[model samples]
Target chain A: MSVDVKTVKRVAHLARIAVSEDDAERMTGELNAILGFVEQLNEVDVSGVEPMTSVTPMEMKKRIDVVTDGNKAADIVANAPATDENFFLVPKVVE
Target chain B: MSDLTRLTISQARAKLHGKEITATEITEAYLSAIDRANPALNAYVAVTGDKARDMAKISDARLVKGEGGALEGIPLGIKDLFGTEGVHTQACSHVLDGFKPRYESTVTSNLWADGAVMLGKLNMDEFAMGSSNETSYYGPVINPWRRSRLDTVVMPTTHQGDGGFVSAGGTKTQRSLDNAQLVPGGSSGGSATAVSAFLCAGATATDTGGSIRQPAAFTGTVGIKPTYGRCSRWGIVAFASSLDQAGPIARDVRDAAILLKSMASVDPKDTTSVDRPVPDYEAAIGKPIKGMKVGIPKEYRVEGMPEEIEALWQKGIAWLKDAGAEIVDISLPHTKYALPAYYIVAPAEASSNLARYDGVRYGLRVPGKDIVEMYEKTRAAGFGREVKRRIMIGTYVLSAGYYDAYYLQAQKVRNLIKRDFENVFAAGVDVILTPATPSAAFGIADEDMAADPVKMYLNDIFTVTVNMAGLPGIAVPAGLDPKGLPLGLQLIGRPFEEETLFQTAAVIEQAAGTFQPEKWW
Candidate 1:
């Protein structure tokens, strides 16, 4: 319900963003405000109401389950920062 | 010929068909205008002159063979968010600075198939996260109309005027004066600017939360957000998947119609793309709105709304009434909850969609001592402040313990908002009319965005409901605010009912005497 600075910092970390202590404090405040605003939704009565997902009641269109990629590996990898042995190379994960 | 550059796509198509001008000439003219105006406006991230010329040559050959499509030889701008095969699609973020997709998006491919020439990729908010175009790594696009005539000759400020001046009056003033730079609106700000300044005839744009319409509104250009499934999302870099829809930003309704037709197509690769028939959007144009019920939602009249916007809404309603449209007062009681719901749902989806870009897949990656470090270093170095902030908030809402309270609850509310629209339309409200934004364009120096995200989010207030409802909405250039910047009136229609929306919009355009840039350009 209430997002504290610690929780905000944890969120920033999980999101892979670098936020300073001051920014964490600020984000906490903003998040609290947003939460406060969202809290208003709790006031509306919907005892028998169904939560709507889409305006139109149409179902998601079905597509073929087959997989036949164009196999443009070289083309797809052309934009990567670094590649080795036809694979994207990243820093070593294990020590 | 200079005047021809300001012509709508339909007008251009007619001229191209008649051989009054060659595709090469039109493409060259737009390229030359981009050359002249881009430096002042900063609208494009890259200008593909060679590709454009080559495409024009092909279009010319098609014309010679009598194989011209609707968009044949028409020059257009593609937003950087749409991946171009060889052209860089950076999402306006440094994180993917050199990231170019090996494939083209279905929408872009469709445009190319229709023989539309690419003027190059236009600027946008970094990863389409911000409402203002300011977050782009390429710097904000200055509205070309702002610069004075002398400024244009000397420093390219020839069209620069105060932020809110109407385009027609501003253009007249610009003609008499020296060079100055005017404000093109944001996200699709660059595209809108390019079209407004006659740098291009039209530009492709994406609307997540009014990115197309808001900028279109600010720049006095026509922008449409078609039904969500109408355009394929396969090649487009994801930004709030459920909400993002690629559309066109053009000078007029007919051009928007043409661009929409050119862009809409079914793609098997994008499962979300509809397999339904793509209609002749242009044929829907000029259809009579007589006896059509137009709803004016009283709930959209938020407190503290500027009187100017209200006056424009009243004037628009009156105009539609005189044109045989039945004006009905309606209520979307859940309208106020839309902004909050959108902020929650869009970011939540964005978080999931963007998770793939975690430094290893295919974007900018910073080498680090470890894999975890690689992600942190890469993301910290790559993403802009706004993007980072969004991802953080998004992750927070979707986290384990918070999921039910935030993410699930928001999803439930999203349904309520959607049903509100369904109820009204079922009640005989053909289309809903509201102000596109609470106010007009703000200054570049405005730091209020940092202080108040809610106020900033309110810019999408009128537009996001359409997205939430998955309905079609168009921002018509209604009138100007006191500051003289263009304010738009939004017409929202039922799902897949773009024809009705465009017809109603055309009536409003005719009645309002919508701003035409050619008269000024």
Candidate 2:
């Protein structure tokens, strides 16, 4: 299925990346081309095939709920563009 | 001293141990080379000269005590995707504006623990999204190798008669790349270009779909994508989590083995890491491949195959034959579907992995009225066009209604493709061989690639299947095309069977001999 300009806008919104009118329009054709190319996968019969859950076959290791590593509040916000007292600052949302 | 930059990693290792040369001297050689060439090559985004010397000093002290680690003082380039603690680790994207990671990636830490010196971070495609390094924000890396114009003046022109000259039957002018720049290939294009031009002894590279192998093939270097989970992924900027893997790009196959030995390890941080003993891959070189079964995948012989690449494949077969390996024709029936399925699976994972890049945590931020608008504006200003396109495609595929028809179906096709390699290997095919790329390097900002993204994706045609199968693959420079650009032959190995790939690749390197671009840059 080809994505229209509206779908492109919706996808961009879902992805949380703002697209201008020009970018959305341009992406419509670009995304359609890629989607069209990948549409060839429909020809393959995937009967009885399970979607790959992991690249390698391994059981997920369960760990006891414990603070294995911690006490690095400063390092977590070390690269944020705006931070104060090791807390990331962002645009206010709640009233 | 002038020739110090030409020495391979193995060679430099010998000199360091023998005390014939100091680590500082070699480090200086590379630093100066990078200083001279990086302006034209654009391979290295950050050259950590002082850090290289400091690390070299530590290596020299260890060598004085005869306690040097595996890589002992050898300088290497780090792909920007790797997080170097307190160093520039932007992945060549504006999204990570001025970001220096607080922690180090496990792979880079492994190299450092082995006494390898850091030459600095290399450039890459923004978030490893594109095939050509053209997608990088810093700028596309210019390949050192260029087409020789001796026999390439193909266009016919007619000139009018002048006072002293007669009308020409058909005039021809020499065509050279005086202004044309060839791409080094990507997303590890910087790593490949640096290694090929000797900007670093070897470089850390990652492969999601052909990032490592494609660039290595273009630059006449050697690169190996170890089996998935072979190298720990912790601290690396995530791309497609399942498909992304860490490897090395080096000047030759043996150097690739040497670098990989130091780069791979199982880490507690990365759960997917394989808990297998890391072998001395350098020891695997020069090993006999007598009676080994090499599979020639019939599907790899794609239509419009270049004559030179085919000839190179034939040459590789003959060399392996002479080396006592039996070439067996095999079929990977789901091969053609691998690329299309990859377009779905990679982007879907990329979309999820890249979600962590919101302005709330780190990097670039654009002010907005609300939190959501802030994220939207920040990401819009930060991510490149190709990245946005992939994220959008990924969101579309994983969105409410289209998930099963697109994402799930692609994953199933992925399983079928993986099974194709499994069935072939189960039939006693020790390793599969194919051309590394359909053609050699193309021009930077090539007009055709600008018009269609699919054309750029086709560059990874042969290399992506290896990643899909989570199998080990190596690209070894085998021959040069008539244009004088390098072409490579790929060897696909079974899971965790990197030793055989190194051994077989060593055989090819021996037969073909390694090539070097003439000093032009």
Candidate 3:
């Protein structure tokens, strides 16, 4: 679980952030520190312990399966940065 | 006229009903106050003066027609994280600098239906990432109470001191301090500051991991995070889907109740929203808390919590006891694991939620020679360092080979934490009492920022457990620290039992006495 500079670099790339070689070294150190602290959790005895999803014991409310969106495609797309006649426009992927 | 700023929401509503003052007058007063105070505090991302005035005019017409809602004509500040139709709803990030949703969030729509006037969009941490408002693209907000005359001498010693002194000492000090602004409690800091400064009556705020309550505590306001699904998240920008819940930030418990009632409803658009009937939250207001069972968790007494916070916690418990509530010692054995589990679960969800903002949607887009370049360059330039760091960490924790080790394990640990609370509640504990945070706000400096991020993450130790459990919690101003900054007492309630939480909070608020910061204006 040690986060090295290479792992840090890959993570940055995956996250779409540009990290310089110098900053990558620094980030690696910080990430390692965080992981080191998190490593403490390994010592606790959790055998037979149930993972909690919520503090309350109530079940999540189930909604009816239905599509009820108000047909506001034009309104929704009005906020998009770039749009075509009826769809969001982006750089050509197939070219 | 200035004294009107001191009136609570309930009192203001009474006056508006009695025809002693028009909604237009109240709206104008708050708009003027926001105009006068916002330049220094920077609490609002956008002020809706025209919208508020128009709403006020309508409210007056309703009054003339003998048709008014409970919160009619109350000016409200909507957090920028909540989508508003035709109003710029930037999430304190340059990426969405000019983006305005064509539809309003359900919470906003509810408030509008209740006749609440929109004051503006409040500022927040970019995408609600940071614990301090310094991460906001619009810059940090200053706590207004710190600007009061009585706080001037003691304030410089606290996190808010520098900004408070500089803003009041005129242009020279203001110019210098502007270069080195202090940190505002993040995510909901702007909402807290606006309420504390009397710039607005109350504001809408969201909490994924103590975002609303922590800031409200730091700024000495009252904030509540309702039970999950109690408030709709449809128009809210997603941070961590499971943990995110919207609530109200107000000057007192009554105001918080008023705002919460108007905003809570079952929304068809939000699949996660509860179908349960919305209650008359105000009906529970001022309800007696005598004979209630209050639990004091032993595990929340972390090692090296400031002595002041410990004293405040004890004082709050003592007050509840005096108010006819029985105090029982409870243990949340899984408390220590709560923080670690939350960091994992929250980030994993955030990584997935934020994937939609990859320069192809509504945010900033950098035109490049090709697709890959466009995605990389755009995101790299659009996001700030802290945001990038979080996104990277989140992505790593959820990636292949790491999922089982981190994300799944965290989920398992989260279950244990939830069970701990359940065990306590089953033993007749109605609510748990704890300190909202370990210490008061910290300074905004490289040294301060350079400290290990986990150390900063620990500040949410007492608050995060509630969110992890999907329970409702409120942060009420307990007392001031030695440095004269506010400290908050946290109240944790069982699932969807906010009525009990608010009643308990009111009893504590009454017993703890009122906080009166010295006025600068």
Candidate 4:
């Protein structure tokens, strides 16, 4: 389960993190080391064990699907690096 | 009394209630200490001096009216991970540079509601990722403690008095005064530093796989990570939603209990925050542990564990036994797999949790020709190396082909680990005891640890199993290593049974006297 540079590049792309060739090369080795450590999990027999999503087993509490709070667009956008009026300004998506 | 800044939370509360000192005076004392020590320690990234004074003034007024809350007039530090309205809440990372939330975290709001004053936002491992606090963008938090130098033994000198050159007693015992800057452990490193250095009465910290307890152990403070659903996570930045639980790092077990009582509450906003009543955790202190069963897990005896840590564990066992508790040897077979499984589950959740920070909304935004390119540029520049590494590891494991092999497999292993704790508890084991960490705090920016991420992740080895089981764990400073640095012993309790942990930890604290470093800063 060794990670190669090509796989590292793909993961970076999938993660939306721009990685240069040099960074990818270094990441290949680092990711491989992590995978090597995690590879030990293969030794344990987990055939009957259910994957635990939450440690405490409780039914997810349901709520009526209604917005209790909103409409304060200014407050939501207060920390935006670049917000125009009520909308967050970003590079044009359609263009 | 002693220095006003050195008062524990209980001590400060008594003084404030007795009108021996005003909240304003104590807050000023802490401010002066922070001014003097923060430059060397870098523990606090933002000091709310004016805000602290304003809050202290309000507390003083409340005391005058004979109507103050539980933690009235006590100043404390807030970890950067918790959101403080209009203050620095970046989690010590560049991604959230200049990002201040309009809302305060539930934990801090609870503290403020109890009349606790905020000293400032403390530094931490960036996004609570690293073990040594070096991952913090602000810089590494220099531990206030350094290894004590060996005592200088001097020979007796001859003195001539009336009795013609008789040998006199002149043995000089000089204490070691070495001043190398040791690390204050991580994730909650800033909180531990502030509390250990007496910069704050206590601090609010979150533990996702040992972040709270490890740092507490390293800095010789008391840290308790309450049960997973004990504290409301609303407004606290999400890391791993299932594992992240907020607790406190304080100067002692009672202070930790006091802070935890104020910090834990059920919130409608966080449905996972259980509706159980928050108990008087401080009251649990001094309760006898006679006839209680303390389980010593066999699997925690990993190879290469330092002799001091093992000795400390033995000392803790003896102390608990002397306090009238029965020691039982238990086997948590899944302990070894906890770390590997934790790495997967934590990162898998982190990658999802951190996806909110793109170029569009809040935080650092680097523009590019297109929205897609803009996201890549912003994230590339925004995140630190360790953060980026985790994101990539997360992305790779969660990718289309590898999901079952890595993410799903890790989740299954996590279940086994949890089941191990349940089995032990079901067998009449009241609480579990183990070392808090593999070793004492290492030097800041150790080259070997920084080079390899896996080596750094190993720091949480002792404390991660508690998180995997969603149980409460406390680190009590038990003894000093041969180097004179503090070493802590951990006690893991059953789910939602933080009271048991508090009682047991108090016994350990009573047996092993509190550790305080000489004033070097």
Candidate 5:
């Protein structure tokens, strides 16, 4: 299954990455080549195998619902490229 | 005392303890070495000289009081992936340009707590994505080791009767012609190069697939990627959550063991970090593996493996057998699918994790008329080519129409691959051994690998299975290839059993001896 230019453009949009016409054209070939390689997985019989999410078989550790750590808004926003006071400044999302 | 920068962690530790060398003196030696060599090697992206001195001063005070930590005053390099408080922690990507974390990563914090001084943040492949360090936005780190050249003068041929000398071969005589620049493999290439070139005593590195071990193999250093949850991944840049692990790239097996002991710890921040007691890994070194059952998987003997690697594998078998360890042949049928499955799972996780890098909160942000347009433009400009390719692949696979065929299929195949390891381990196989890489490191941006992305991904062939299975694996430099470049043998251990790997790898390291490149930088 080759990924066409239309699908490549759509995937780029879905990924929120702006792809130029030339980039989309090149991506069609690159994505297709990668897909062509990954298609080899179809040969393996994984009919009854359960999908694994964690490498170690353990439950997520649970604790009482309490605030363990926080209140360092200054630390969190220190690395923000655009910040106004304590709040991170971004392009206005609200109309 | 020939070069204080050449001291390994253990040697430096002893000297510092005995008061023969102060922490400040050793730190100055490494900083001077980095100053001299970093221009040619490009190993370090950021050198924290002031902080290193301050830390060393504190360590010196502790030594004066006759109280010091495990790695008292030892200088080391931190990989760009690990976040240092108020330091450069961009993971060598343009996306996180100028972003410095206010908090330190758990691994680095642990190392500092053990009295290890930070020399600098080392270079790496951007976001730890590429096999070679060529994908670094800061520029490819040229390895310090060049092919050894023989000192030969192409003397001009002239008869005694002739007054003037004439060249027999053309006048353009070549001296020291064999210094071809070889690549120190990635994504821990910087750590490997820094350790191999004596810029640092030991360096912190991370491995999602073969990042730690492969680079170690290429640069003739020792590295270990402990079990998935062995080290806390709290502040390290997340590549693939389940697969990513922090390890050490050091000068030898003993140094790697010492570093890993400090690096691994349970942290509340990263819930995946196990609560088990971090073992004394250094104690396991030089222990006899006399009756250990070492597994040799037939599946790793892939088609067209290099003759030297095959010979090296056989040589490893002989070394272990001679030491009274039993070698057993094993089969892992699902080995072939590990790479394909990993590409899917890693990208899927990367796409999700990288989604935070929009134009809103931090790092590089491009402006546009609308918010959506801003996100599109920011990501376009911020991410590199390989990163965008992974994002696109991830989005396509996880998209509504193709989720089952790609993402879910890959996950199920991942289970099968893990099961193959489980079966082998259940059969009482103490450890599994294979070549660290299918071949030694290739040239930076070599033509054959540059043509196709998958060709470069194939570099992880021998080491990815360990990651897929979530097992501890160590790479020990076993022999030199035909070009005199080092090749390594990988030892894979059961989950949370890094000590066994340390003990077994010592056997190979003992036989192979240590490999260091001739000084070219």
Candidate 6:
């Protein structure tokens, strides 16, 4: 199934990455190429086949859910473009 | 003194213990080599001179005290993907404008705990997405080894689908490849280039889908992607969570063994990190493969494969046979579907994993009217074209209407691919061998790759199957192509059986002998 320019734009929007008209048009062809490529999967007889969930089947190791470590709010926000008091600054969400 | 940069990890380890050379001396040698070669090769994106020497000094002290760790005194390069505690850890992407992680990745921490010295961060495909190094925000890394102008091979192209086969002596024969820049395959491109160029004793690299093995093969270096969860993914930048794995690209098989021994560990931090003890991989080297069942997967012999690659595969089979391996013809019938299935699964997970980069905490932030617009703008401006493309593909597949037809179907195909390998191994196949790449390193902006992205994805044709199964695979340099570029043979081992890969690869390394480029860089 090939993606139209509309589909490409929608996908890019859902992905939250901006794509200009030119890029979306280009991605239409590109994404279609990829979609066409992966279409080969239709040939496989997976009628009763289970989708793979994990590479290794192992019991999930759990630890005590208590706070093992913390108190480095500074380190967490150290690389943010804008921050105040270890709080990351972003465009105001609400008026 | 002789050029200390030429010493392999094993050789460097022995000399450090023998007191013939200090860690400081070896680090200096590699630093100087990197300084000279990096400008031309563009292998290392950052050179941590002070840190390397400081770490080397610590190693020297430990060696003197007879308390050195496994990788003591060995100077290594960290892939840009791995966080290196306050060092450059951007995954070679522009999105991470100035990211120096506060925390160290669990893999790099393990490396440091073993006394390995870090030379610097190497370049890679941004977010380890693309097959060629061309996708890096930092310009594509130039391979240290270039094709000789006088030497020529039948121009071979093995893309995918019906048109993959380019006729012999195809249109790619240009005037001179002697000076043309070839890519050390990505996303571990820089890791392979640095190790091959002798910029570091070895380099830490990762593989989601053949990142470690493809680059290593192109540059005539040795690289092994241990079983998924063999190395902790605690802090290595996540690409495709389920598929991403950490390993090493080193000068030779023994060095790869030495590095992996230190790199693998069980971590409480990464639930996926296997709890099994790391083997003395070095001890596995030189072990007899007399009774080992080396399976030659007949499905790997893809049509339109170059004569040299086919010949190299034959040579590998013969070498193992000579070393007393019982060669068995095997069938992994689902091999052709592996790469296409990977394109879906890897991207679907990548889109999810990359969602965390939306201008909130770290990395580039492009201001907009609102937070949502801000995220859209920042991600658009931040991520590279290939990254965006994969994100779009992933977003499309996981979208409401297409989820079942695309993503789920791909995952089911993944199960079939895994079953293919399982069936082979269950039948007493020790390790399956195949050609590492379709052709030797191609030009930087290869015509075929530029024309179609799927052509680029096909570069991992043989290697991707191993990752699909979560098994260990090693790429060892075998023979040189007609163009004088190195060709590599891949050995896919059973899960967590990296020792067997090391043992078998060492035999091929001995038979084919290791290759090094004529250093013009």
lDDT of the structure predicted as candidate 2: 0.92
| TM-score winner, 3 or 5 | 5
Q: What is the lDDT of residue A15 in candidate 2?
A: 98
After superposition, candidate 2 runs with Cα above 4 Å error? B151-179
- What tens digits encode model 4's per-residue C-alpha lDDT throughout B322-425? 99999999999989999998888888889999999896778889988788889999999999999999999898899999999999999999999999999999
- Listed per model, the TM-scores of chain A against the true chain A are 0.78, 0.92, 0.80, 0.91, 0.91, 0.95
Q: Model 6, which residues run further than 4 Å from truth? A: B149-177
RMSD, candidate 6, Å: 6.9
Minimal lDDT window, size 10, model 4 chain B: B159-168
lDDT of 2 by residue, A1-95 (tens): 89898888889999999988999889999999999999999999999999988878887656678889989999998888889998889878788
**Tens-digit lDDT string for candidate 5 (B74-191):** 9999999999988899999888999889889999999999999999999999899888888888888877655543333444445231322335552432324255677899999899
Candidate 1, TM-score of its B chain: 0.92
Q: RMSD to native for every prediction?
A: 5.1, 5.4, 5.7, 2.9, 4.5, 6.9
Q: What is the TM-score of chain B in candidate 6?
A: 0.94
DockQ of 5: 0.79
Structure candidate 2, residue pairs in collision: none
For each candidate, report its DockQ versus the true two-chain complex: 0.57, 0.80, 0.53, 0.84, 0.79, 0.82
Ranking the candidates on DockQ from highest down gives: 4, 6, 2, 5, 1, 3
The top-ranked prediction according to TM-score is: 4
Error of 3 at B349 (Å): 0.6
Encode model 6's per-residue lDDT on B136-216: one tens digit a residue: 998999888888754233553553223233445452333244888899999999999999988999999999999999999
- Give me the displacement of residue B175 in model 6, in angstroms: 16
Tens digit of per-residue lDDT, candidate 1, span B284-396: 87888889999999998989998999999999999899889899988888888888878788888887787777676677788777777778778888887777767877898
Greater lDDT among 5 and 6 belongs to: 6
For candidate 2, the TM-score of chain A alone versus the native chain A is 0.92
Kindly give the number of clashing pairs for every candidate. 46, 0, 6, 0, 0, 0
Per-prediction fnat values?
Answer: 0.55, 0.87, 0.52, 0.83, 0.77, 0.88
